[model samples]
Target: MTNPIPTEKTPPDEAPRFAELAGQVVVVTGGTRGIGLGIVRLLARSGARLMITGRKAHRLERVADELAKLGAEFETRVSDVADRDASRRLVDETLAAFGTIDALVANAQSYINVKPLLEITPEDFDLVLDTGPRGTLWLMQAVVPAMQARGRGRIVTFGSSMGQTGAPGYGPYSAAKEAVRSLTRTAAREWGRFGITVNCICPASASHRLPTNLDGDDPRARAFAAMYKDHPLGRDGDPLADIAPVVAFLLSDASQYLTGQTLMVDGGGILRA
Candidate 1:
């Protein structure tokens, strides 16, 4: 059996209209590969000066170099988002490199193997919580101060379908992402007075690593595939095509009136209720 490949059709214009992001400084965490990388690519193509952070120095540098060819002013930092000090350093470095941060995409996260709640050790729980929820909180704390000072900013936090529906064997991950959703709402409420917008996206696009995370033979995976088969769009969603534009909209002034909202990009997978 062959693995299903995800695909998307190009928009009619083959170009985005919200070019206001040009000259803006944006930071994206965990941007070395997968969905994060897709966001970085789209944002760069839209002419934002991008600063990306990840734990791997080589991969960060490689991605920075690739984006440079597309006329994006790029910078990279090797930092683990789970570390508060490192997260602060990432923001400081971005400000030092780009002068100001106009938008932030908190996309860094670690996935653990699906196991029974009792099977998960305290250490495993700590690792996921630290990387997903705690990291997001610290990063927001570090950046929002500056954004608030400026009286304008955009923040996009990542959530998951599992987080919304509480899938089995993914307790820790779901819990962490739920916390992210909560944080997003809270930030939007508190920061809106300062002209800052905070929102979360529950992205359901296919990725190379997600299949391995889900047990290949599990009934859950089969159910997911069948849902996609009968999706309203008749295909798996592409992160670049389906997810990136929404993110760009949230980041741009186009979505200035929107905040404290969770947008689902799941090809109607979670809407089968």
Candidate 2:
């Protein structure tokens, strides 16, 4: 029951055609792997100067080295978003290195095993909320002021399919991501006057974090395959191929009028609002 791989041919006009972000600076949290890595790769290809953050120093260094080889001017910081001070320091360092901030992608998040409400512990709830919701707020607070002074910025946060539909056994994760959605709107409303746009991307894909306990022959994966079987354009999303161009557009001047919206990159899996 293998899921059919999704094809992602770029539309002739939609290919990476934004104004060159040659000197623009971007900070992508959790950029060491998976979806975050996809974003870094695309932004680099578009000539953006990137600064990525991850908790693991070794892994961050490795990713930085690889991006550097691509001739991308980038740096990495080992910082935990949950730590307010550490998050602030990362932003400070980025500004020091690049002299200004243009876009901030708040993508770091932690998800645990799905559990019934009664089985959830305080620690479990806090871990999810702190990273997804609280961390997003703290990171935004740190970067927005600078953007405001400059009178422009783009903040892209990550929400999820689980957050939008409230799927079973994902109570904690759902609650946290829902909070991110709320924050996205609130920040958008507050920052619109400053030429800043805040938005969320609800992405559903086979990222580095695979579901635990799913056998190769498991029905759950089959169920997912079936769910996406009739995608308007059949197949799953390639984080880099499908999502990056959209993000680059949002981060560019062309999307100046779009704000506070939740855009899904789920291969049309969740169609209705």
Candidate 3:
């Protein structure tokens, strides 16, 4: 069975309007599910042409079809960000389909086996780093030239609160996320002159296992409840409500002056000074 396509929960008359993005083209990695999908849906509503990618062809096609229903102009690629060659090619494929690239959302990531810091192997570290920061670097390098030609671009990368305050049993994943934050800051400074803004978002929106998975009295449910109880907000965020609108802002012209910052959309979970 396929995951159902998401619908805007707001009534047509009450939907929030955003800046025009009719001719803009965006490339979203890992765009088939989770917060990435939420970002894509918002962009679709804004009339942006999109190039969305995922490791699974079936999922990519399913997502593309759903976007088509919204009258979105888009293309889909089945590629892994961990493959440097494929990541570069993804840029080429998007430009081929869309003529130019205006923005990129580097949302692809991998969480390797959760284990204690001492027990984390070199292989595990490599897997997490390779998929997270390494892949983001490759895609950024590939897309920068196009943005330079136009003298403008928007780039959004994913960071995590785990990177700031380390999480137990998530050592390698946390480290990789920190590396991505470093990359985001460095790129923002380097590319600012070229009219590109790079920022990171640390989102605590629901993962695939959301309300349904939170149901029942299993150990997982109890653990999830404990986690939510500690949040500043009583519950976790909904992707469309708590996350994607912020992403949409970063991609819009209004956020032109902001770069190298990490916006924590975690319902105030982690406070940064």
Off by over 4 Å in 3: 1-17, 205-227
Candidate 3 local lDDT, 1-273, one digit each (tens): 122233334433343445576668999998998888877887888888999988899888889888888888899998899898998898999888989999999998977755678897889999989989999999999999999999999999998876776666768887899899999999999999999999999975365544455444654454344455446655555555557778888988999999999998777767521
Please write out the lDDT profile of model 2 over residues 117-183, one tens digit for every residue: 7899999999999899999999999999899999999999989876876666678988899899999
lDDT by residue for model 1 over 1-273, one digit each (tens)? Answer: 234444466652363535888788989998898778878888888888888888899899889788878878888888898999988988998998888999899998988877778798988889889998799989999999889989999999999877876677778988999999999999999999999999999876445444532335774564455445445554555556667788899998889999999998776767752
Q: What is the TM-score of each candidate against the true structure?
A: 0.90, 0.90, 0.88
**Candidate 2 worst ten-residue window by lDDT:** 206-215
Candidate 3, run of 10 with poorest lDDT: 1-10
- Model 2 CA deviation exceeding 4 Å by range: 8-19, 207-226
TM-score for model 2?
A: 0.90
lDDT of 1: 0.81
If ranked by TM-score, best first, what sequence of candidates would result? 1, 2, 3
